[model samples]
Target: MLTENESIIRFFKELGLEVTSIDLGIASEQERSSTIQISRDSYPGVEPHLVTIADIARWFPELTSSGDIRLKQPQPDVSNCESLDIYRQYWEQLLSVTDIIMGFLKEYRTRFSRGEYPTTSWAHYFMNWTHETWDSRRLEPAPIDSWICYVDPSIRPHIRELNEFGLITRESCSGHPDDHPAREPFWPYVMFEERAYPGISAHLFTLADMACWIPTYGRHGFDVSLEIPRDVELTRGNIESYWNQLISSTRQLMPLLEDYISTSGVDFYTNMSNPSLFRMPANFQCKDMSTTGDFSR
Candidate 1:
């Protein structure tokens, strides 16, 4: 078995890539802090909590809702935004980081697969930053290309499972009517899928169609599917179960995902090391558990 560092190095070497000199210290620290925050929120008061947008909204309604009842409308639909320039800015920065990291992994994988010694710096950088932003919370939009590049193909099965469960919807990419360049190039020809849930749609894509549309554009010619859950009556119990199922599926796939990357010689780090980048965080972890399942259960 590969040590964590060795495994990372070997995985990248197998992809035939090189590492850059950028320090991942800040990113790693941010990720660790995010992890600790999530852990604390998840395990508060000796009980484990499920992480869902509704749960967070209930616990911190102030963050989500306006105080004046008259002024309150449904949450802003992130999908219908007339302009996403602000979101685009953040996304580009994140993608840049993913790119460098993945580039190194690709190079490392190329060397390793050929039975050659791997680059030491590449391995070290990966080990230091490997855990950074592994969870969904840190994953923002923008650097979606990196997410596609680094995500393990094994997760595709879970995506299919989610679709079967009515948690996601699969469609031809060309069917969507959105006209963004991101959406246009991949249309019609590529098969696509998307999440069916309203809450997750708002949180991740900031727009309802984003869970499906963004991937279509980012992946371009590749046939891809979106992974989202369907919105049912929001009850505490049902929401909890749905969240649990999704989280369980994601967690179960983590190891196999790493193995898949290693075996396939995919360069995850290089794809993620750049500053202007966006990609989905392929990993998921528990967060706050305060709300009863009724919020969406």
Candidate 2:
């Protein structure tokens, strides 16, 4: 089934209405899911699923007329409280830092290509850049527990929605480790490694991270990490080429997440213990968390 956004855009085009834009960025995936849930509660037995653009428009008339949908959430007042935005902030910060580091790597790569041995300053410079970036509050490695809290009960459904698209969680943390002492310790986030690249291989596009945190005393949000592998040659051209490939593979995450929020009716409650089969929607395979490896709490 086409996602809510895709359906809306297609429907509007069919109606001869030029859709300038669909505002999925401002509203979070969880908020859309909440809105759909509200509609389900209000009109019992209408349909268990909300998959088409008309489904959303029928429930939210404003979107039909204005091409914008905003669902009021029972959330405390906070600036940029949307989970997607929070996630975007974190992802973009890391991307920006990645760009900066990649710039240096490019220079190093160029020198290496010319058969010049890298000076110790290259390593020192990389460390310095990391320190400066963290000091600026622009980028930092998020704790996994905080991410688990922010996504549970709301945001994670969208993550699971990715399963339908051939992406599954390789490993995850429910964030409450102490609850099950006999089981593996609770982790803070989820990791999708080589499995993220279905047909593709090589370290360049094999890793992604999803995490969340409380940016303020009361406000909570999410962030993502994409690991771009440094080529053996360590050349800037190679780094950029690989980076582009990584982006192309994972760029759909935000948009698809927004669409899932708007229309998905799935709430996956799979038991991770069963590695051989997943409870996810059809066409998606069950995850194997055993090979996902240990993560920082």
lDDT of 1 by residue, 187-243 (tens): 222232221221222222211121111211213322223322323433445434443
TM-score of every candidate:
0.19, 0.19
Runs off by more than 4 Å, candidate 1: 1-11, 22-160, 164-167, 172-191, 195-276, 279-297
lDDT of 2 at 13: 45
Measured on C-alpha atoms, candidate 2 has an lDDT of 0.29
Q: How well does candidate 2 match the true structure in TM-score terms?
A: 0.19
lDDT of each: 0.26, 0.29
Count clashing residue pairs in model 2: 4
lDDT by residue (1-297, candidate 2, tens digit) is 897566655653442233444544345434332221112211111111111222222222111122122221222234544565653443343234323323322332344344443111111121122221121221222334445444444225434543434343344443333433577533233444222321111111112211111010001111222322222232435434443433443443333334433332222112222221112223332222223322211
What number of clashing residue pairs does each candidate have, in the order they appear? 83, 4
